[model samples]
Target chain A: MKIERREFLKLGAAVAVGLGGGLTLDVLTKTKPAAAETRTDVAGTRVSSKALHAKRWAMVVDASKFKTEEDFRRVKEACVKAHNIPDFGPDSKHQIKWIWEEPFERTFYGVDDPYLPEAIKKENFPVMCNHCENPPCVRVCPTQATFKRPDGIVGMDYHRCIGCRFCMAACPFGARSFNFVDPRPYIKDINPDFPTRTKGVVEKCNFCMERLDQGLMPVCVEASNGALVFGDLDDPTSDVRKILDTHYAIRRKPELGTGPSVFYLVGGGGAGA
Target chain B: MLEKALSGSRRYWAWIVFLLLLILVGFLAYMRQFEIGLGVTGMSRDVSWGLYIAQFTFLVGVAASAVMVAIPYYLHDYKRFKDIVIYGEFLAVSCVVMCILFIFVDLGQPMRIMNVILHPTPHSMMFWDMCVLFGYLLLNFIIGWTSLGAERKGFPHPHWVKVLAYIAIPWAVSIHTVTAFLYSGLPARSFWLSAIMAARFLASAFAAGPALLVIFLLILRKVSSFKVGKEALQALAKIVAYAMIANVFFFLLEVFTAFYSRIPEDMAAFQYLFWGLDGKHSLVPFMWSAAVLALLGIALLVIPRTRKNEVILPFAMAAVYLAAWIDKGVNLILAGFVPNPFGQVIQYAPTATEIMIVIGVYAIGLLILTVLYKVVLGVREERA
Candidate 1:
């Protein structure tokens, strides 16, 4: 909630002076008069487009409920539909890349291997884009195609992506994907409302921007089978806000200081299960 | 035969022809890649960087190797280097030519490379890399030409030539270091996040680049009309030996630090590459091969009898080059991001087109080196 103004100033000063009042500054401003009233499934929150960007979007996953494959698949489908993303058959080269299902028992290569919860005998968390506070992808992109929104969501300007994929390399998470071939071949039915990417552009989860634009909850949140909780970290009254406050939610790569928006609840068993 | 051996043989024509044919095939492959986009390659989401980048990293060492010849001729006042210094400049020219080509095929839009000058990202290391590579390329060309022209006219090298020659030393260091910054600065990939990445890159470049140059020199000695005495190459090889030793030591230091510190996040990457974390065994052999090659190269260079043996030295250098190239390139760069942040492991292999682009670029470099060497060799033969 407290975006350190001093830290922004320090980073901004070292950067090009021409980049004045970018999306970060837009975060503090009010939304347009029109989009001020809309519904999000999270209880105790009604906000405008201005309010949308004012608060950084974040997710809290309660890994306890993700005990079944059905639970994980339900949320994955929901997120995909909400984004209007086409998921081609497995092994299809043109498969529309989106959300990942990480096995629960996994540890950061050499990092901690915490005790496996009883329920998560075959555990892992579903991961999308973290929408990092400091995105390396945005930094390395020569095209400036992938920029972060004011509310801490990483947005893509598909029109601008020359598909250089430097962002793909710069990203530590491997969160980004490149359309190596023509994506249209795989896009069986085009979603006119939500656009598809051209070949040679890099893409990843947009944190369900299309849904956010229409004042609806991200499809992943609705599909999460009570596993995923979405909320504004700035607002203490919201359900996602409440979840983060009540339970000990874990953020990925806490040391990286990218301020990941996705949170994980514990669950999952030993590896190779 | 001895007189011709002292100069350099006509076998240069055969190498030139062979490289040209490879380059032609490579150009055809690149055209196909451009038409189809990168999908022709094995790259997917999990494995982002593949062969193009690997070749770029390797040839960059070749480009940086020019510094060996540059320093002795321009700085240390080693008179013996005069005969081969043009070859050094020519080698840098070709390697850089190849470096730029490898990158050209890797880009999504080759035309957009011009954006570098237009956008001018002062903060981005990539921006700096572009500037350094071009500058290094131009500087080597100018220095080599002027030196060759002076040698032809049977006059002492002009003073203005030394200006560019001296600048090439630190400039050589900058190209590879800046390339290192391309990766080491990325905080997310713990494998490339080490503080000594720049030094490690330089150490590895020193090890591989000069070894390549030494081998090339020996081949030229045997087949070419040009002649290089042992003293000049011994000076270069001695330095290469130390660089190889340092490179191996630095690699060990990273291994020690990763394991000793027990930073699982960092170690996880090493485990995936070296010990096959998550039941994957793809990159382990390449990693071990590089380690073994590094040791063998050091052994050859360290021992006087083996080091002095022409047959053994060239063979040793070849082995060292392969090892270091794989270490800095394929495994070090690609395997860093396996299983991605989302725990999805993606595998990558370069397509034929990707390999072709690599070859084409080498062809272009060879073309440049060939012409430059011809001009220099002509003058040297006349003078002798």
Candidate 2:
């Protein structure tokens, strides 16, 4: 078997190519069944109950109804309690926030005109993770730890997150928080249902996917009375769709092309008007 | 060859011991950081990346700078650089090791570093950066080791070695370019989003990398029998001077575009760095110092008399090295986050622990460099 150098090299290259191709095919095929199952489950659930299955989750906050500080506090408190987010107190430099308050101007800085209504200008808007259709945080995450779920909710897999904080840097809204310290000690009352995060890894609002699975509204939405509305944006009949259709609403940094799901209703003015 | 590093003077042993002590201190600090979290550092939610990342960015430039010597020597057959090219490669090897360490320490979950490889997101610049950095490290190691061995044997390097060296020329440029892309592609941070980022990075790297190389050669001349020669040093000085000029020019261009446009978003970071933005002026003094030093360094190098004077040359190189380090390693990353996405200034200063960790990484790089230089010099001496 006298094989020339050129022929031998050609044979080696072919074997390498064949092995690489076979390995790629194996990897693709192995993951297909799990993905297919999730897809089927989503489709089956959608067919069984139109109201239960979310194609795109979204939220709307009515600034007019959220008049008092107490009203805003309740919504924040509910979210914090539901998520087991640590409270580093008022003085802590690096506090964890699943939901927090920001002035209206700061919340929608670029969009807001200088001639904004005085009432809207002074109001403290409750801001949280927007769960965008095109999320920069998800794009920058090396691990798909923070990802968009089938329901269009941006989900955080705390266990899988390497806590690189690239997502924190990538999030335009400052929506994500890193567990700079052990979050467990700071958490006053641990939620038995929700697991507390470790000293590393990022955490953010998950749109209450767990609660939704149990046929409950997001804790923030439930606490907001009629101020906060949550529903499937893909469903034409959903409350969020109806509210968005009928009212004048704004999403944060829409120009950034993130397609934020959280909308603000600033139409019914009080002080400036 | 391995025994060469082991047989060194008392000064060499002392230097090695000093680096070891620093490494021990850094290891202890890192242990504390591991037990807690990245919270031990001064980085916050607003300023997420801090000292570690900044150092990583700077060292990557230093690593990429090896191409300055490699290109002139290998591609152009520039005889002057032939003796010193291996030193540049060895310096790159050390810089890369430090860069990798800086990144590892910066990670919130250092144990899960392999997730980057397992997940392999093409969309993420970090994924690409990891690929290039590791590839560049391996390429330099193979080329440096193989070429040096061939030189020792008085034989021409294998054909494959030349092919790898050619591949390395473009690969060096790509490493820094990819690093710039990591910041530039982000839409959220207006300060980093610029077309000139990669170009600016390359210019700075070419200046800083060779400056360090020249400094090392000068030290080697004094302590050892290794002669990098007068012509070699002068040629390297020319490269450093040109690159430094280009780097400063690129930075001035950034300043002009930002201030002239008067887009508050664009000007915010520069304003924060040079002046005080919203009363936060921690970085103001350092940035000014960097600018002044850079100008003075360029002035010294541009003048032939000052550049050629051996006594004046070291000072000029040191000034350029410090200026570039301050600009890239300290100001650049910090300023990018300032006037953060929400147009607010949240100041960050590295903790004692963080600084110690940085010092430790540097010590490790120096130790690696010293050992590598010792071996290469020994081989060359024996052959001579």
Candidate 3:
């Protein structure tokens, strides 16, 4: 029952924290809900005259419609130009890409179809961040710098990101990219409406959160002709859900249990070879 | 205590100056990196982490090894470890300092590091890792300094010091376990998503930590009045032998699981490490070297004749240390990111700038260790 100097100090600290620290924490937490609403507004919801609202956002990519390399290039260019994603050239290891093309085998892994249709086999699939319903990236992010919004957009606060790249490691889709260098100089054309990321912060396709706030569709969807469908997944009547319902769509690495919001329509292109 | 480090032999001063010079070079490289970006390093979108995180991972093991010394002396009340436990604690202090620095340098925004604490996300293993690492540093620093000070004044350590020592034993295991969780919990990297990751990390840390302690104690015995008896060194060697065997056994278990099950994703990283996976064999040589060295270390340590030889023992310990460093540090972090999620292989070699920064962090850690050890040597010499 003897209290030594160390125990005495511990008791004092406990008392101080119980009284002063609790009061400080109370003041801090009291203002949290108001601040969180603003955070949600800044990150997800903005009350515009024509702003789009949805419980969960999702995408359906008609892989068959992307017949030529130009189809992929168009959407990529639209995203890059709109986001001010720097062009580090083809050979640069430090390239930042928002949307890019991957081979069919690489995109939807575990596919061992030997006699795929020539059209489907030759075509490159467009891949980007799935904005997962249960994002591992968000779970691993130390600072809540990346989080999931109510609308199902996996959002990133670049300023808050400490650039640990935990998100990059957590993302199974290879979606996230870190700015290895100052990205401003590499940007061919700076998008004034959108802010460019500094070196060190992790970034990926944000489903055009900024554009969505303005009642505009994602630039990729707009530039994708009929290949890309973006809408509310929570609403079954939405275009993305409708396409998902009608087609035998598959997500990237579904077995991993990330519940990818993005789906690709396969076997929808003519008959198999 | 602080003044003891200020006065040292010509050779000690020379070593200090050399570390300072390396620190200077590293500082300059870091400033350049700060102005430019991590682009100065070889990391790309494909391979995000490299040497900095690797060194951090390795040092965490070295830091956690203090528990090996603590358990025998403090928990088991073994008198043989009484003189050396302080050395183990001081070594832990320096390593934890280096671990924090490595994380600091690896940060995209070092200035914004407080954000992790400010917005606490208990769900993030990185957050837990930060908490445990810092807590371990504080624990070791207080325990080592307080106990050493009491000894310097010719009195037993206060009652609470013993309590803190017991707490530190579990704290040591937690630091490395939390670090393993940082990788193991990730869904993307098939290489790291293993249930045995924490067990493997603890096994390696136990081996590598004590092996390092043996080397440091041997060096201390040679150059100073500090001399541990042969029995203590032998006891440490036994710990290293058993732990090294456990580490290798755990790794073989992983190999068996990967190959026998024939999970392509699980096998891809092992293939990338041991043999060239799709003509990308950058890490194959390192992995093989670690395997050979680990086996050699085990052979040297397992045999009583070689383990007892003070001259040969240091070499065996060095081999153990390097193997653990390469396996846990280099291979684990780098190869885990390979064949990325897209099944693409992008080669990642640390840039010269990255290496310099790494050396700088090591120099800082070594400098701290030298100063702390100097103080220990000074206090012991007075007692003698």
Candidate 4:
């Protein structure tokens, strides 16, 4: 077959687009740290003056004082309800989890005895999607259904999901959940409140994109009695930064190379803080 | 008077009736799924993929095995395979059709699948997978069926058939390679995150796919009085034996490196798969059984005495099919997810509805194969 001018142009465009995508990724990787150095002023922008670290969303959970199951319920209920996660028998359909309390042994990496009632501090700390810096979910999703935002929070395109569930399979944290069945019936209120996911699709925590659009902290943060601290991680002056500076904080599965955005702080028997 | 030879054929009719009943049951089950949703199946959030995906993985290999015939006879010009070559192509046609159907049933909404074609995602491997698989199916059907149609008309085969033959060989290998990449390219799922997965997928596909084709075609040879000679059977069996050796070698390499590397994350999945972690349902039994079957099958094929024995040859082919399916179908996907990343053991089993769909998909495949076989056999026999 003879080559047409349009086909040639189309071929050129394909190559250009391919290279453009590669170039954009390269620029992003290179420009990230240097951009962090140029830290902009939040006072002049739409960001809250009080919420100094507009981008940093971090939490310091003091697991030492938690004695009973009620402590776990209070924090978990607030976190789950805030995100409007559709509850399964106990979990969720696609398991729409924002936070939870894993047993000390499950949470820690390596220790001779992870659960020492007195030494280990048997309180509950909430766990949510890490929203990794280099998320494997985004890498494996064949449909770009799952992606990491420029701001570091990961998001999923419900409509684009082919129900292949590759993202769920790829996540190290068991973070993504696939909608094996239709979710619409279980959601009676229609949650025009939150975006509804379809059956045979995958859904997970989006780090609460709807609230972010309205310029508010995540519902879980607001529900907390100073439990979760949400702010700009890039800015050092944010409340999350102050907390991180004051106490030692840890992330789940730090060795896997998925740089977690959510941090945890275990301290003096504090009430879910 | 001529009917005397064919009257005791309740077996042929019995098989058809049985498969039709299964297809009906499958259709009703599918209707229930469409009305209620995929919830009718056993799959949930944690165990996202179930039996349907497993079957798809297995059948894709079946479709790709047509390559063995194409490679040796077409590329290398082996005369013994001349008769079995057509059988391979027809098997491919039915398998690919079944493979596509299985995926369609697996989807949440079959209609929305068009979006993948309409609004393409080049970055997505699924996009390439769709294009390659669909193209391979059409290419095989047209090239195989059209030549058969020409033969039935008492005409010399078209020159275009030769060009199509050459294209089909590489095209066959690509279908499985691309399928393997669909899993291997994923940066996560340490179990499948290996570099040599694509090669392993191809090797396994060749071994199992042709062995299956031989068994299926041999049945046709016996029942229909089709002259599929011993020479064709022997050549195909030998090809399968070589492919099996490669598959086993790859498995050993994976085991050796995974155990030796001292990486817990990588080794953990394998340990769960073969040895069973701390007494939770050891897949080791299934895997070892598959290994045993494969080795026995290889021995039965490669040795001169075993190859001469008709009983051993067919038995070996069936054994080869079982080994390959267990390795790729049941174990491959489960191994990746077990002892889930949090180090918690998760249990998964196909629900009744899930099993029904699987049965339906197989019945559908057999139905297609039967029709294709009848048509091709009629044409070929008339010519003969």
Candidate 5:
């Protein structure tokens, strides 16, 4: 079992080289440090100095202000363009829309109203992920593919999603969409900035997290012409809270206790109306 | 035991060949689905899950049904089930294998399936389901093989085998209960959201599982030297009858609750399944047929003369099997997704490719069942 001096030196050299290689590998593989404390980039991506920060990001939709189909279309177009969302033609089966419109009756089905305003009923309300305070999708995801950030946005990591579609079933708003087919083929013009998903993974609105990192407002909010307001629910001075304070706001399926961040300013008496 | 399965009669080999062909076809269909995407199936964004999930749900119950035989034999020391208990365990092994396969095939990213384990999220029922289903498969395979081997060698099985059997009884219940929770825990799906969902799942499972066992037993009687006694068949039929009645009772209770409360959310899915929601009636025919067959099977099983009649029992069991398949296998999962949370009625039907793929999975299950059953019969025949 005794080792010669030459053999001992050779083994020592091998051990030293192995240790040095391992240390170098560890440093190389380490994730890049955050740009700053104020604005945290999600995936080691660059964040602009003037990036938006929120304790809990929220969106306030004044459905009453959405008067025309063009208003809805423009906002939807902006999101589609920014996100590189696929168009699965008109068929609803394989369709992958991050943000879309539903009629007033469907959007506010939980808010019972036998005698609602005809104008409100006629309008198509834009719906996306509610990003619930107690998000079921996050709770149900086996791989944490879909998770809620500190800012209260329910973010999806498409690469990690095993595409079991449990999150799709868990969402009450029908916000999530599965990539039934390869989404790359359907994208008319792919946005290189935002990542496009492959087939078999579930996807939904990320509330423009990357844009927030770049100090840009959500494309839908910027496009809506005052119909959609994006702000921090936690901040009292935020637009969402100010609007909540001034006018009564209703959330979809509030009874379910998901505590949705998205609020609808439907004018009359909110839920009672 | 392995040698017993390898060598069989012309009919057995022919059956094996048929299953292999089906499996080959199914693998090809699955490849296409893998290449193109889940779009090859009839599933949509609205009906996020289709045939694969439904079959997974159904087979979980079937796999759990092995407990029906295991319990009476192991717990109650029911001597009648002693001769047939191995058959039940083997059946479970096959069904559990199919159950795992169904879940694997249903995944959008099947390759990343290890992620379920890689990053274990205990909060997710799926992770727990993965644990329990695999655990159940292992328990059954070990118990069935060891017990059969011990019998062949003319010795009592080890005490650890009995301890495992005890663990399996509750473990069996957990596999189906967790599966029921996978649906019932979801707040969005009102149809599946009920206090009695687990109970209903157990009831249907008890009915479906034993009825299937009876059919397998009858088939064994015909094709091989394996003979499950008339008393055992009758006892199993009684269990099936009681469970089938309970299943129907649970359905009626749900109907009553939904209709009485008149909560649109609660009633919407039921309306979609039984009648048509927004003029969409794709599931109505299937649902009605399930109802009628369920009632018919219950009546036949309850009647003493019909239950005692060997010729009639198989037909009655078949009715029960088909009815449960329609209700739990096809409609339950489909109806849960109907009205799509937006209250829109979107119809879904499986494609030919999807059906072929399903057939392939069943072929795998049957192949396992056939080989396992062959070994059991071989051991018994050799003893005789």
Candidate 6:
């Protein structure tokens, strides 16, 4: 398509500004590597190589192991407490759920059959940000505030977000949440470690990058008692890769071709059918 | 030049005063929204967009409608539209202003709206939309002002102005197409994801814009001595008829594909819009009314006798205007959200504050129209 001279000039200006903003963001987010330190566990054993960079982060939740509502609630509480996500209880319209529960039918909505077994149909699955390889939210973000990191984690820069809600609309999984009102008042006990979001900006699960940086597993994974697997998918030796190779796990809305990193192992044959 | 608009009758001043009052009330409501956030309005996480974005979508078509008059007068040398073309451009100018205001008010971080400019992502359709809208606004402003100035001076319009007019013809189509692209490209909303969205948008715009123009021109004819001849109105009615037919046909194409394919995701939105999915029928009556009105409007305009009749022509144009409005402004955006990603219904209805802001925005548009028309009429009357 041939653009008029004036239109071209306007576009040029926009590109120039975009480049400038990109440089600024890079400078602001650049962090020191924490002096290449090694950490020891409580029993004085090395748990992980602290300086090792994850090539691709992924999560796999075994649905059968999450048998009780209390099991799901513990995971939710850990994520919420760690992230300082506000509680807007029972008001679904205003509620901000980073990771929440859904029925098996709703979780695997389009793929699931109507006449599935009652036990399978009644199962509740814990859902969160899929951290898609090709995230629609990142693609549609006007400000680049929501982006897919090199580690296959979809990240949000709340400070840079313009609050257009475009990311919220673009997320097909409904993973993103907009702070419709000031979230501070509703937050009963703010976690000092995590920063709370202001009203208007969109937010979602960030795969707990902060916890990972400190050589710790994500709070949800820790709370799940071996039910949830978290590891570098790029590493063939990682726990997630091992599980994917052995088990039949499905990602939500895989037909959309987003290539979601989060996988679910429902175990009982007809859960996906 | 602006002094001419200032020198108007008592009725003109009264109208301006009324618009100012509405604007004041809207401003107050906006202040409240600014403090609290979009939660002050009816918009939820499910329905992220509501009245503000809807009006923005509708008025973009209104702004682009000026092309209907411009193309006939400038491109085809249709002299019948000569006197009224300025009004069309002026209407477009006002509508564009209103469109900008709607977007501004809809923004969560209104202050950071400049980020769209500061950190533009060309991949984002919204960024492209912003560029084209601002460009279109500038094009209309320059074309309308220069042409009106040339007319006031009693000189032949310059060669450059004609070139710009030609450029504007396609640019007008691009503005609406780009606006449609803003919705269509999103894979998240099945209701908006379609190849024909831009074509459908242009068809609806071609009908709605011209229809609104005709109604405004008829009103001008009664209130003032600004005469848009019978032949001109008839020709416009014909354009409206054909465009409305295409628009309705495009909509039906969507319906046919959704139902025939039996794709649950594709059919879900339409079901929510027409019959209400899972007991959510908020937009059901409105969608049905718009469909009926569109049919009636098409029938009225398609018949030559009714189309040519002055009294009936206004009714026909009104029907076309309201039908397109309800279709685009009310049904389109809401349907995109219902059965949201999780396949659940979350209803949305605008609060009083939201409604008042909409009214205020319309009043602002009318106020601009009144002032611009006053200037155009004064210049024409002096020449006469």
Best by DockQ: 5
Estimate, for each residue in B1-384, the C-alpha lDDT of model 1 and write its tens digit: 113223444566676678889888988887788887788887776677788888888788878668887787778888988777877778888888888877878876666667666666666777788889999999998888776677667788788888878888899999989988888888678888888988888998887877878877886776556878888878877878898899889988999998999966668778877878767778889888888888898999899899888768888888888888889778887877765765545666676677777768777887776666666666666677
lDDT of 3 at B335: 92
Q: Which lDDT tens digits does candidate 1 get at residues A1-273?
A: 666654564444334223432222121122223424343324222333343443778877777667678887888776555444655567744355567676654423333456644445456667777888888887887656678876788988766666667788777666677777767666555655566666677778887765565466777777765567777777888766777666666777778777788877664311112
Candidate 4 wrongly placed segments (more than 4 Å): A1-68, A91-96, A108-124, A184-192, A241-249, A266-273, B1-14, B282-284
Better of 1 and 4 by lDDT: 1
CA lDDT for candidate 1: 0.73
lDDT by residue (tens digit), candidate 3, A88-205: 9988988887799988878976674678887666678889999998999999999999999889999888879999998998999999989988899999998766778888898999
In the predicted model 5, the residue pairs found to clash are none
List clashing residue pairs in candidate 3.
none
- Quote each prediction's TM-score: 0.84, 0.91, 0.92, 0.84, 0.93, 0.92
lDDT of 2 by residue, B1-384 (tens): 678889888998999999899999999999999998898999998899999999999999988557999999999999988888889998999999999999899988888889888878988888899999998999998898898899989998899998999999999999999999988888788888899999999999999999999999999999998977889899999999999999999999999999999988889899999888989999999999999999999999999999999999999999998999998999989988877666689999999999999998998999999999999988988998
User: Residue A47 in model 2: shift from native, Å?
Assistant: 14
In candidate 5, stretches whose alpha carbon ends up further than 4 angstroms from where it belongs are A1-48, A267-273
Residues A120-205 of candidate 6: C-alpha lDDT, one tens digit per residue: 78999888999999898898888898988778889998878878888877888988888989999888788866788888888999
Give one digit per residue, the lDDT tens place, for model 2 in A31-122. Answer: 11111112113222211111245889999888888788899899999998888888898656578988878887678866667887787788
Worst 10 residues of 5 chain A by lDDT: A23-32
Instruction: TM-score winner between 3 and 6, please give it.
Output: 3
Choose 1 or 6, whichever is better by DockQ.
6
* Every candidate's lDDT: 0.73, 0.85, 0.87, 0.70, 0.87, 0.84
Write one digit per residue (lDDT tens) for candidate 3, span B1-384: 778889989989999999999999999999999999898998888889899998999899988668999999998999999989988999999999999999999988888999998899999999899889989999999999999899999999999999999999999999989999999998899899999999999999999989999998988888877887899999999999999999999999999999999988899999999997889999999999999999999999999899889899999999999999999889999999878877888889988999999999999989999999999899878887
List the DockQ of the predictions in order: 0.31, 0.51, 0.62, 0.32, 0.67, 0.57
The digit string of per-residue lDDT tens for model 4 on B310-348 reads 778889999888999999888887777766656665656
